[model samples]
Target chain A: AQSVTQLDSQVPVFEEAPVELRCNYSSSVSVYLFWYVQYPNQGLQLLLKYLSGSTLVKGINGFEAEFNKSQTSFHLRKPSVHISDTAEYFCAVSERDSSASKIIFGSGTRLSIRP
Target chain B: DAGVTQSPTHLIKTRGQQVTLRCSPKSGHDTVSWYQQALGQGPQFIFQYYEEEERQRGNFPDRFSGHQFPNYSSELNVNALLLGDSALYLCASSLGLAGGGEQYFGPGTRLTVT
Candidate 1:
């Protein structure tokens, strides 16, 4: 079984400031990593994914994440944030062997950007 | 280019009651998965349907069941619902096998059990 852990439950940042949301995972086998964002009353939207290849994965809305194998981390980062970036962020993982495997999600980190 | 979609954006039910939620996968999608998202929590996997069959399931009980039609649409049914079952029910869709591609999500059906 695979599991994900998001260290921060909430993070507050001012507009134009940089931010990072930490995520770690545990699995016996190789896995794929992903980051998603959920706006109030809406379903989740994929921010980026790390299937293979480059360690640095970029996504919409000026967000990017670095996959660190030794540290077992996929921390999401943004050089600058906007008020509209305020949303709940989730980190997820799934096994690489099977496409049918269920994706497990972390508790989530609520990002609040202040004007 | 429609994404995944679910019906009854919100629903209210009482404990012990049974409810059904529906979902329509994105165009060209053939797989659908259901998840439960409790307040202040991440969405938990329920089950996945492909080729009109359930290919994988999570730790949820048998009380939670689902079916996929020939058109690739799906329905989720819960029996003897408990207060704890009150949460947002999300339906996601993917092409081919679920693991190989990204899953597009629906707006979700908010189920409130009183």
Candidate 2:
């Protein structure tokens, strides 16, 4: 089974500051990666995904992630974050194909933006 | 069109009782998957239903069951529920196989087992 590890539980940052949420995955088979953001009192919204092709993938809300196969990591980053970006972020991993519809997610990282 | 919507946003039940939660998938999505999210934890896959049949499932026990209708709506039923079942049950809809499409989540049904 594929599993994701998000190193941080909470991140406090000032508005417009750069931030990085680290994620690592463990899987024996080829896998797809995803980042999802859940605002308070709402469901999760996808931030970005890395299926194949380029190692770098850009997503909504000025967020991006780099897929490093050798390191087994897909980390989400933003050059400058806004207070609106404050939310709980999750990193997920799934098998390469339809053989698996399950997506294993990290515990999640709460991003708190300070004024 | 409305996005995915779940019924009974909040529920309270006693241990050993049975409960059912409902979900309507996003328009155009044929696949519905259920997940359990504990407080401060990530959502864990429960099962996936496609074409009115269960196509895939997670590690949950048999007490955790589900059904799908022709309209692609889904229901998750927990029989003889345990206090451990207290969590936010989320319903995520996808166009088809997960690999070929993105999954969208519903607001979720918060179940409180006492």
Candidate 3:
């Protein structure tokens, strides 16, 4: 079984400040990792993914995450955030070998951007 | 092209009642998956439908059923719904059954059980 853990339940930062949402996963086999953002009253949108490539992955809205295999972490980071960046972010993982495998998601981290 | 779309933006159902939610996948997508999102939580996978057949499922009960049409559209049916089932139902679509590709999501239907 695979599982995702987001260390932070909520994070508040001022506009244009840097932010990092921590995520860790546990899986017996190799896995694919992803970050998704959900705005109020909306479905989730894919932020970025680490399928099989460089450790660092860049995503939309100037967000990026680094896949750390040894630490079992894929923490999302933004050098600078905006008020529009306020949303709930989720970390997810899927088994690499399984075809059409189900995704396991962490509880979620709510990002609140303040002026 | 339009992204994934789900019908009945919001629904209110009583406990023990049944409900049906519909979804249309994005253009050129063949795989449709459903998920449940409780308040302040991440989406939990319900199941996936490909080629009008169920391909994969998560840890959900039999009360949660679904069907896929030839057009690749899908419907999720929940029988004898419970108050705990009150949540946002999201529909996501992808191009292949491999499940490694990115999935586009619909706006989701908010189901409120009373």
Candidate 4:
């Protein structure tokens, strides 16, 4: 089984400020990590994913994440944020084992960008 | 591509009533998965359907059922709904055979139980 934990429940930042949303995971087997963003009243949109190869992955909207194997963490970061970046972000994980492809998500972290 | 699409953007029902939500997978995709997102919580997997058969299911009760058609469209049925059942229902689609767990999500259907 795999589970994700987003450490922050809410983060407020000024526009153009850099930010990081922390995520950690626990899995018995190799896992795939993902970040998704949901705007108000909308469904989730894939921000990025780490399946294999590079530990550092870039995603849409100038967002990026690094997979730390030893720490079991996949933290999302953005150098600069915009008002549009204010949304709920979720970290998720799925086992690499074909039998467990279901993605389990964290509770979510709400990012509020201030002008 | 049209991406994944779901119908009945918003619905309202009373307790004990039944509701049906629909979804159409993205073009060229063959698998459909259902998820329930409660208020203030992340989306929880309900089930997944492939080739018109349920290939995976979450911890939901038997009252939560689904059907997939030959065209890859799917329907999620919830029986005897409770106030807690009110939430956003999301549908995701992917190419199961190609592997990789990248699933594209639809806008979602909002169900409000009164």
Candidate 5:
């Protein structure tokens, strides 16, 4: 089984400022990592994923994340943020080999941008 | 192509009532997964269906059941709905035997239990 923990429940940043949302996971085996964003009243939208290869993954809306295997962390980052970027972000994990595996998600990190 | 689509964008029901939510997968996708998102939390996986069979399920109770059709469309049925069941039901579709691939999500169906 895999479990995800997002260290921050909420993050507030001024417009054009950089921000980072921390996430950590625990799994016995190799796993697939994913970052998803949910806007107000909308379903989740995939931001990016780390299946293999590079530890640094770039996603839509100028967002990016780094998968640090040694620390068991997949932290999301953005050099600058806008008011439109305010939303809820989630980190998720699923076992790599199991075809029928279920994704375990973190509680969430709400990003609030102040203009 | 159209992304995953869910019907009855919003609904309201009383306690003890049964509710069914529907979903249509993205084009060429065969696997569908259901999730429940509370007001301020991330989505929790309910189940996954592939080839008209349930392949995986979460820790939800037996009241949460699902069905997948030949066309890859699916439905989630919740029996004896409680206030806790009131949430945004999301449907996601992916193209694979397993649901670990990239998934496209629907706008979601908001179910409110009174």
Candidate 6:
């Protein structure tokens, strides 16, 4: 079984400011990590995923996440954010034994970009 | 690609009534997975269908059932719905890679159970 935890429920930041969204996971087997974004009245879109080979994975919209094996964390970060970044971000984890099926997602963090 | 497609973008149903949602997977994709997302919450997997069979299911009660057709399209049926059943129902499709494949998601069908 796998579980995902996103520490912050809401994060407010001024436009152009750097931000980080934290995520951690617990799984009995090897894991694949992912981040997804949901805009108002829209479905989820894949942000990025960490399968293997690289610890630091870059994704769309100038976002990146670092997978720390020991800390069991996969935190998303962006050097600078825009108002368009205001959306719900989710961190997810699936057992690597499976390709990415049955992934468990975090509760979500609502990122509000204040101008 | 057209990604995944779900029908009846928004629906309203009274409690105790049953509802059926439809989905069409992406081209060349044979697997469909369903999730329920409540307001302010992330999605929770409901089940997955492949090859016209229910391959996987979550902890949902027997009230939730699904079917996949030979054409690869699918439907989710919820019986005896409750107020909590009012949520966004999301459908995802994938290539059915063994283990875990990154499933592509559709915009979702918003169901409001009154």
Per candidate, native contacts kept equal: 0.62, 0.67, 0.73, 0.44, 0.67, 0.63
Give the Å error, residue A66, model 1. 0.4
C-alpha lDDT of all candidate models, in order: 0.95, 0.94, 0.95, 0.93, 0.93, 0.92
Q: Candidate 4, residue B17: CA error in Å?
A: 1.1
Judged by TM-score relative to the true structure, which candidate is superior, 1 or 5? 1
lDDT of 1 by residue, A4-108 (tens): 999999999999999999999998999999999999999999999999999999999999999999999999999999999999999999889985957799999
lDDT of 4 by residue, B74-114 (tens): 99999999999999999999887333568999999999999
Per-residue lDDT, model 2, residue A26, is: 98
Q: Give lDDT tens digits, candidate 2, residues A1-115.
A: 7889999999999999999999999998899999999999788999999989999999999999999999999999999999999999999988886544678899999999999
- Fnat of candidate 6, please? 0.63
TM-score of each: 0.98, 0.98, 0.98, 0.97, 0.97, 0.97
Model 2: fnat (fraction of native contacts): 0.67
**Cα RMSDs, all models:** 0.8, 0.9, 0.7, 1.1, 1.0, 1.2
Candidate 2 — which pairs collide? none
lDDT: worst 10-residue window of model 5 chain A: A95-104
The sequence of per-residue lDDT tens digits that candidate 3 reaches over residues B4-51 is 999999999999999999999999999999999998888999999999
List where candidate 6 sits over 4 angstroms from the true fold: none
- Model 6 lDDT tens row, B1-88: 7789999899999999999999999999998989999999999999888888787778899999999999889999999999999999
Query: Alpha-carbon error at B112 in model 2, in Å?
Result: 0.6
DockQ, per-model, please? Answer: 0.71, 0.71, 0.79, 0.59, 0.69, 0.65
lDDT of 5 by residue, A1-115 (tens): 7889999999999999999999999999999999999998788899999999999999999999999999999999999999999999999998888877567889999999999
Give the top-scoring candidate (DockQ): 3
Candidate 2's residue-wise lDDT over B1-114, tens digit each?
999999999999999999999999999999999999999999999999989989889999999999999999999999998999999999999888757368899999999999
